[model samples]
Target: MIDLSSARLSRRGFLILGTVSASALILPPFLTAEATAANRYQPFSSRLSLTINGRQRQLDVDTRTTLLDTLRENLGLTGTKKGCDHGQCGACTVIVDDQRINSCLTLAVMHEGASITTIEGLGTPDALHPLQAAFIKHDGYQCGYCTPGQICSAVAVMKEIKAGVPSHASSSLIDAPTFEPREIRERISGNICRCGAYPNIIDAITEVAEASA
Candidate 1:
């Protein structure tokens, strides 16, 4: 048998319990909602102004958005393919400030006020860039999923060679890197072509390099 007589709570204890209960009930719903919203992950937007393909573009994008997503989803530049968003495949490659980067690996918010160029920026339907023309002439792409990245990387590779940038394949670190087949292959190793159009790609890049030289 329980001692019901001695189990009674004191007046002070009752008052404390009542106070807690009242607090829980009297709390405004909006306050609770605000607290919940604060704890939850919310998408924050940031204003971005960058030059894309020689045109100034301003957009409000989520801070977490990737550069690839900004170009494809926000800017409607779908030419930069998204293959292996993990940055393994170079389909998401783009040129930023004359440097080639995997757009999928970079956040859009990081490149504010920067100059960016995508595959579409490289050429038009009527007049093609030299690399693009060479790709078509040599059949550098089969499925063409990786063609944009390949062409972009190829353009950078030529620029790097012209600027005397030494690559790993270069024989002399101090001397300028030559546009040898091995050097070209080594430089573009990051780009993966599932259709195995490597030979044609190399040929196209080689043709462009020679013509520019």
Candidate 2:
């Protein structure tokens, strides 16, 4: 003999309330799992063993780090400038396994067992490498931000020429390329100096090339 009218809800209201209650009961675990996953902090790092500057070094770095960042941040090798990190400016150039590459564009993990040579590796303040000396002798740089990459690239360019690698500016495609000004310019074109020091750079590179020859 209870009042059924007071206890009864509209069919739509009943359905909506039941559904909401069911959702509330079922959603906590899912929401909690998602929140836990979001809050989880797992450091992602890798062990890298590489020869840097003629010294064998081991480092534990985050997998997402780039070679340039590792060199600049972890190893304190800031001589390699990071300009136009898109790899277009070639300011982060470094020699890896005898090949010059834009360090900014490469991951440190990829070169785990490779030999890396940065600007600091090429020479010291008192004992300068030939190219380092040549760059200074010819005033090859103005701002000097791009000088490190230029020097590294010039070293590789000389090696490439000596290895008989032909460039587009080479006079004869079948024959070995000559180390002329045009060839040097074309070879090291990837390394740009915004200060319009092309002539001086060319002069420095030519001096080094001739000396190496």
Candidate 3:
């Protein structure tokens, strides 16, 4: 016969062993089931009001949806590119209250009452914004996937410069705040153009800076 008395563990040790066994049996199912249920649910449909492109727009959107998704999928504003769903790529950059931000990183629900300006709001074919026209003239883009974000970022960069925002490359020796190639490149480095059109993109910003001066 097994020596039950000799094999017996202390009450605390037995409790710990039983607790571990119970956790192993229940934890995995609870986590997996919760995640699966969350993924399967449709977007929460709630009417959201936002000011986009200087106009008030109202739409029903999922509370879990990102601002980029609401712009592209719900509002049909596809000018903001969705290069990477994550915030790593600046392709989804937009201006919110004069500050440039990645739309993909923000939720649509959070942008309520905020003024948002996307690529579509930047310029038109006939009256292109200086940055947009410069991009076209200097061939600042390649496959055109990152053009919108680049242009938007370029515009905001200028605004920042005009407001005396110093970049990491700023020289302490320089008497005046000169937005040279380094500053422009550093400011816009977040937006990656896979086609490798950095030179032309810099040139476009230079042209706009010159015109603005």
Model 3 spans with C-alpha error above 4 angstroms: 1-43, 168-177
In order of TM-score, best first, we have: 1, 2, 3
Alpha-carbon lDDT of model 3 = 0.89
lDDT (0 to 1) per candidate: 0.92, 0.92, 0.89
**Best-first order by lDDT:** 2, 1, 3
lDDT of 3 by residue, 16-82 (tens): 9899999999899999999999888665677888999999999888898999999999989999999
lDDT of 1 by residue, 100-211 (tens): 9999999999999999999999999998999999999999999999999999999999999999877766454334576777778888999999999999999999989988
TM-score of structure candidate 3: 0.77
Pairwise lDDT winner, candidates 1 and 3: 1
The TM-scores, one per candidate, come to 0.80, 0.80, 0.77
RMSD from true fold, candidate 1? 6.1
Per-structure clash totals for the candidates: 0, 0, 0
**Candidate 2 overall lDDT versus native:** 0.92
Worst 10 residues of 1 by lDDT: 168-177
